[model samples]
Target: MIWPPTRPAPDPVRPGEESVWDYPRPPRLEAVRARLRVVLGDAVIAETEAGFRVLETSHPPTYYLPPGDIAAGTLVNPRRGGICEWKGQARLFDVQGGGKAASGAAWTYPDPTPDFRAIAGYVAFYAGPMDACFVGPDRATPQPGTFYGGWITPGIVGPFKGAPGTMGW
Candidate 1:
């Protein structure tokens, strides 16, 4: 593995599309107005139009919804946490709703670094574990890999990180 390895060529972007390769390296947090929804089993556990997304090079956006927009009794903080160089510490949450539960499927930064302070206490879900996740009306696929929580929507293109052999990137 090489440090500062060359990035793979990004997929061709059609009109009105976004290439993840064009995103910044340290990542950028941006407010989003499109409706974001997370469904588990038969329940819609989270929905919001006032969410935010973190975009980084070689990755699709990771959407964060306000805690107020999530259903009551759906998130259980389990004391598991992780550190991100860009976002600071993140506390993990188990998602329990719609007759199902997924452990560590969600996370939040109770006290985020200043760059991401706007999303403090907001939660981001791993779309792969949910029955469905949507950005606007488009169903989102989970970004490839076990670790990253990016949601791949229709308009986002990538040769994203997280696949095997990309860790060095």
Candidate 2:
């Protein structure tokens, strides 16, 4: 059963609290794939119908796709792993495309909960780790550090709560 019929309304921003209500909703199924183009150096990774998902975080946007669609051959198995309260445990991978590729860059929830079945077996990339990540028709250089992905567009206003110290806001 879907937990909430619709996402809960963001909490009200109190005085001195960082406002993050303007954050964009997860990209629609079509929008995410339309703007994605995978490349390995000069070679274009085949464009296929890969799954995509946006995790809720204060940082940039996170894009998820099936391992079959990604050039997994270039990924180096990493020893790090993490768990998500809403999803499940994640196994990390380091991109090994020479020194240009992002290291320890991707992660996957091999066995997510039923609600997150769409993301199961799919790998998600940190937009910050990629050289280029796009949303819709806009192409953006990934932000530095560990950002999720940003969906900021004209008329979009967001402070997206949960950055470094703004967790309780």
Candidate 3:
């Protein structure tokens, strides 16, 4: 198992919360009812309570919002593409709103693995490059570094995977 049972977890996690270190190796997809909101510049680019979260070891939850709930024409122009070992190929997008744009700041998996089929038409934004993303009243902190799009809230703890010396994690 990737989780070291003998390795003392960093923080004391309450009964109902999770520690990223103890998350599963293959990751899990779960429905999220938390009000998810994405902002870029002054515009509320996307907002939805119908979202999904992918939970994996050493990473924070990456929220995926439903397309219908997002603002019209917010995601325009296809950019590059990426491959996730677990989720399959993903198409990137340019998010333009409030007179500003973040190229390839968001992505979607049109055809995903069977395990991730529920999120096929959903979008996940990189909170680091976005103006803000909120889960209910608390604003999220983007997962550390530029490569991963996990959204970090106060509930999650990490020596999160994407930091300077943690790439091998």
Local accuracy of candidate 1 as per-residue lDDT tens digits, 57-142 = 99899999999999999998667589999999999999999789998999999999999999999999999999999999999999
The clash numbers for all candidates, in the given order, read 0, 5, 0
- Candidate 1, lDDT over the whole model: 0.93
TM-score of each: 0.96, 0.64, 0.91
User: Better model by TM-score, 1 or 3?
Assistant: 1
Candidate structures ordered by TM-score, highest first:
1, 3, 2
List the global CA lDDT of all models.
0.93, 0.53, 0.88
User: Model 2, 128: alpha-carbon shift in Å?
Assistant: 1.8
Least well predicted 10-residue stretch by lDDT in candidate 1: 1-10
Clashing pairs in 1: none
Number of clashes found in candidate 3: 0
Kindly indicate the candidate among 2 and 3 with the higher TM-score: 3
Predicted structure 1: clash tally: 0
